[model samples]
Target chain A: MDLTDRPDLAYDVFAKACPSRGTLEHVTGRWGALTLGALAEGSLRFNELRRRVEGVSEKMLSQTLHALERDGLVHREAQPTNPPRVDYELTPLGHEVAGRLLTLIHFLEGRMDEVLGARERYDTARGGR
Target chain B: MDLTDRPDLAYDVFAKACPSRGTLEHVTGRWGALTLGALAEGSLRFNELRRRVEGVSEKMLSQTLHALERDGLVHREAQPTNPPRVDYELTPLGHEVAGRLLTLIHFLEGRMDEVLGARERYDTARGGR
Candidate 1:
């Protein structure tokens, strides 16, 4: 599936009407990225996910999960146990996406000093904006 | 820098207060992602970029460029020709980031059929939402 060589994809995200754009948004959206990153480590329950993702509100986390699940990047399992256990984990496709995402993430984290220095220089040049 | 093995990076994006999270948002935000991806092919004038990115407004594109520039991921070159010329291109760091972004993008574009199929199954299970 070499997209670069395929003209039949009909999914150029650069085009406004492509559904790929929407899926891209779901994968890269603020909460969605973090949620996927957290799940990449392992499956987690609802509350566990909320805690791992830091500042996501319950509503937002739920919504994010639903979106990911609908896109087939996430799988949700509910157990009819005493307290009704539910857990979420990445699908194989989700793992691949998360791996690429984490590569970018870790790269940025490793280069924060350069980024911070650039910010300082930009601000100083802008008369401390 | 092997972020997985480094404890001193001190820039965990999963933490709400980490500045890396802000950088991640700038790189992956709707317009930001599109803008960087567009520039990865080559430098482009402002109007050229807007046309390539397909739905970005003048104001949003300007704002997105400023943010990327401030973050050191974009280089904005202004020329003093008669009508004046401004071009946008990825910095070396920006190129690296954009490469990773494109990988994810092309992957998504290639798999959109699976994604759409998932969406259809999901909507059907929900009684056609």
Candidate 2:
């Protein structure tokens, strides 16, 4: 069974000590950026998602999706066909968050040059100071 | 000495495997959230930042600033006046990052209701499923 299709985790952003932090970790997790990027385009099967998001382990992908699904950001629909097909999409709220995340990603990619420069200065000053 | 003023850590976001991730941890770290939030308003002294962020421990705040400074996302200047006065501000790159972060924060705050609703459904369905 694809763990992404399971619904068990619950995220609470309001509470100070809620699972919200963990949920944030999952949503912004390393794979999360890629997963959300793919979902923003459209729903995809587990394997399809895996391809779109490179460098993700099957276990991490499954765990990330479970966490996102638990937060009600991503929706997981399982089709009961002979082989049991599953697809994932963003919920309305997920779309909002995805929009912001995409902005961050695009911004990061756009500013890669500046970030590179900053890294150099940071490294030099760090060594001296 | 305020750990925030020290320049030792270095962040490299480009490298697939570098201290970048941990630096990201510091910049986006839990307190990193508040630190950036405060710095966005304007350069602030460490104590002032501590007051504005609310509920942040001295250790976490210091660590967060140290990380941000290493990444060149924050500029720390120590004034050698009567008492050692230090102020922190966002570097140009930091300002860019902080802008996007603000967007995310505002978006999250605005969608709190929807996110809360999603949380409820997630919890209920999770219990049953």
Q: Give the C-alpha lDDT of model 2.
A: 0.70
Best by TM-score: 1
Docking class of 1: high
lDDT of 2 by residue, A1-129 (tens): 563364222322323454444445455566665677679989999999887776577998998888788777899999999899999999888888889877766665555456556667877866954
Q: What DockQ does each prediction reach against the true complex?
A: 0.84, 0.20
Model 1 chain A, poorest ten-residue lDDT window?
A: A1-10
CAPRI-style class, candidate 2:
incorrect
Candidate 2 — which pairs collide?
none
Could you tell me the lDDT of residue A90 within candidate 1? 98
Residue A5: error of model 2 in Å? 39
lDDT of each: 0.93, 0.70
| Per-residue lDDT of model 2, residues B17-107, tens digit only | 5444444445555677557867988999999988877667899888888878866788999998988999999998888888987777666
Q: Please, what are the lDDT tens digits per residue for candidate 1 over residues B82-123?
A: 899998999999999999999999888888889999999999
- Candidate 1, B8: how far from true, in Å? 4.6
